[model samples]
Target: MIPEDILFEYNAKIKAFDKDEKIFSENEIARNYYQVLKGAVKMSNFNDDGKEFIQGIFYKEQSFGEPPLFINVPYPANAITLSDSEILILPKERLLDLLTKHHDIHLKITENLAKRLYYKAIIASEISGQEPMHRILRFFDYLKNDVHELTSNSSFKIPYTRQQIADVLGLRVETVIRSIKNLEKKGEVKIISRKVYR
Candidate 1:
């Protein structure tokens, strides 16, 4: 559970977004650190050809935006709402001040950074060697580890569309569709009304 003091401190600054709305854009000045209180956010950026590629996804209860602040750079990616969402925003300076005063918060931040680094390593490895279908499968497996029984028939919801999944997996949209079709053919997974079931 999140610490109540953190919620109390930033409650007044919280913001909401509707699905597909931009929460923040790439190259925007890094001024706030955000904690996802509901729904999901996709972090993405455009390639030279102006095609967007997803960098990561943040689910409910996760925090983001501090890395760019710590690095003293504008935001590296665009943050977009995957669904109607609520996020708590604290000014970067206030967050830094909290870190300075709270040892536990500092440790939590360090652990978050470490987990991000580990995930980055996995993504890099997949980019270098894994096939797109395998990469997507691995990503689903990773999500399942965090969220038990993640299929549509289960309790939790998958908040991404097929095109969004394609972008996040670094595959052409057609490739993503075909991969899912193949998985269906193999009896490995099923897509029903745009929801994935395993």
Candidate 2:
């Protein structure tokens, strides 16, 4: 993510979005690069059956929807604010100009894009063939590792609701709830105070 001072130097603008606001829809032409300055954003989509699939959830300092900027393609998923948030936006042309001048930022963008791609690949693999229990554990383990907070059999929290977790895993909320409880009973995880820990 670009630092605040760098954004200032670029004259990048910040905009506020209310909770549940749609920042952009699937297939929208990508015109700007965005980073969350506060709150959260989720990139998601609904299939023909109206089943929601969460591509990813992004928090402060995280950038989303930038692949479109680089590829000159429309967004593959919709971005919506998970809460009232401030977002930094740099126009595509300005971002390209800045990248041309700042090799470090360009590398950072590459790293960010790589991370997203890796995550999507992992999720796709998990969803396609894994059992519910394996899928649940692997998914939470992935989240924990991403935060660099993994510990041997120690507990950690996933910053998402059961429904959100289900959406991301392409499972029903009830299935997620049942999976978590089963995992807990099997000593693989614990659901304390209605929050998941593993």
What is the per-residue lDDT of model 1 for residues 50-83, given as tens digits with 9 covering 90 to 100? Answer: 8888877888778876688898899989899888
Give candidate 1 misplaced runs (Cα > 4 Å). Answer: 1-5, 10-12, 146-158
lDDT of the candidates, in the order given: 0.76, 0.88
- Give all TM-scores, in the order shown: 0.82, 0.92
Specify the highest-lDDT model's number.
2
* Model 2 per-residue lDDT tens digits across residues 1-198: 888788767878999999999999999999998999999999999999999999989898888999888889999999999999999998888888888989998898887777668778888999999988899898888778754447756678778999999999999899999999999999888787888887
Using TM-score as the measure, the top candidate is: 2
**Per-candidate clash tally:** 0, 0
User: What would you estimate as the lDDT of candidate 1?
Assistant: 0.76
